[model samples]
Each structure stands twice: as C-alpha cells, then as structure tokens.
Target: MKNFVFSEAVVMAGLRWTIVLIFMLFGLAKFAEYEAAGVAKIAAHYPLFAWMYPLWGESGASNVIGTIELLTGAMIAVGAFSARASFVGGLMGIFTFCVTLSFALGAPAFWEAGYGAPFLGSTGQFLVKDAVLLAACFAIMVDGLRRHTAP
Candidate 1:
C-alpha cells in the first residue's frame, strides 16, 4: 500500500544488499596473490591467524578467509526470505569484525604515540573502520529479529 511506498523496510533492505555486495567483492578479491599478500602482512601480526603464514602462506590463508566472507555475504543477501539466514549472517559479521578488531591489541602501528592517544596511525585508522561495519551488522541482526518475531 501507500505506507509501504517509503518505509524502514526499504532502507533495511538497501543496507542488507550493501553488506552483501561489499563482502562478496572483497571475498573474491582475496583470491588475487597481491591482495592475499597484503592481508598476510596483517595476518602475520595476528596471533590466531598468523599460523596461516607458516601453514599455507598468504594465498592459502586468504582463501580460507575469502570462503567465510563469501558465505556470510550470501547469507545476508538471502536475509530477504529467511530470518535464520539473517541471524547467521549477523553472527558471522560480528565474528569477522571481532577478529579484525582484536588487531588493535597487538598492532602498535594502529595506536598513536604509545597506545594512549585517541588518534591513530595509518593502520589504526584502517582497522577502526571495521567498528562501523560491525555496528551495521548488529543493526541487520536486530532488524531481522524484529521482523521474525513480529505479531
């Protein structure tokens, strides 16, 4: 009806699709050697994923991360039809960001001066952007829950 012409649902749908597009494209890009190597530089610093460096190198580690990204994107895209998919998508979004966010702990370059200032260096600036995406994912998850539980 007229009420549906301009609505929150439409906005939520747009946000959902945006996440899908970004995640999928980045996932696909990880397959490239250059891109993977770039990630490897960072993953190398990360304790949990750094093992990828020894076990499979940048390419191998990237492939693993890429696969997960692709799956999360697909699930978010499919949130239009299934609440369960949205829930999974949201959880994945949170998981991915949490790991990336953790980089703030070990990566000194992210901190300005000696880790006391609010301002960040280039790497910190880069990683900080994920906080926004993490929030977006949380929003999507909540939206999905609202729709699913609505009477």
Candidate 2:
C-alpha cells in the first residue's frame, strides 16, 4: 500500500472544506430565514413535511435544522478530530437523505389528503442533490479513515 503523506492529508482537508462551505452557505440561509418563504412554498409542494410547519413553524424548523447543519459543516471544515467529524457528518448525510426520500415518496399520498398536488419533481431534485452530497460525505469519511490509519 502507498504510504500516506502530508500532501494527501492536505488534499483531503481541501475536499472537506469544499463540502463544508456548500453546506454552511445553505444552512446559514435557512437559519437566517432568508429562504423561508420560498422554502415554505416548496415545502407546501411536499405535503409530507406539512407537519413540520405546524410543529416548528416554517422559520423555526429552518433555524433548528440550519443550526445543526452549520455546526456539522464547521466541524467538517475545521478538520479537528477529522475522523470523528467525517464519520458523524457522513452518517448524518445518509440519514437525512433517506428520511427526505421517504418524505418525498410519501408526498403523493399526503397530497391526496387534500394538501394539493405533490411536488414530486422538486422532491426528486432534492433527492438528487442530497445523493451527491451524501457521496461527498462518504468520500470524506473514507479519506479520513485512511488518514487516521496511515502511519
């Protein structure tokens, strides 16, 4: 096996930073409620998340989820204890994507409940985006694991 070097580690850090930046920006937007109205609009398209609006309010849930996203993003970017951070972030990404997919799939049924037409298209787009993000997370996790185990 090729021995790991500092240069490889730096490259991994850069990759992690790129992923973190994207998530950070999106998370910050949600936290500031900058896209709340738009999010609320799109969210309406997916009736599956209707309960979220009622439970946390459009802005509230946005803020809470945003905060979590921001924290995780920061942790990944910093690369401090990178292995743990990568593992957590990777797991979170996978979990979030799965949950969102579940919601998206159920959206049609939710709409039949009188919520209106499902935004299956937008939901599909969201799934695609998350899948990409999940892939990035997995890559980071793998890089981190390799870095940690390297001599």
Q: How many clashes show up per model?
A: 1, 0
Deviating ranges (above 4 Å) for candidate 2: 1-7, 41-52, 107-120
In model 1, the runs with Cα more than 4 Å from the true position are 1-6, 112-116
| Per-residue lDDT of model 1, residues 31-125, tens digit only | 99988987887887777888877888778999999999999999898887888788779888888888989888878677677665687987799
Against the true structure, whose lDDT is highest?
1
RMSD of each: 2.9, 6.3
Clashing pairs in 1: 110-124
lDDT for model 1, please: 0.85
RMSD of 1: 2.9
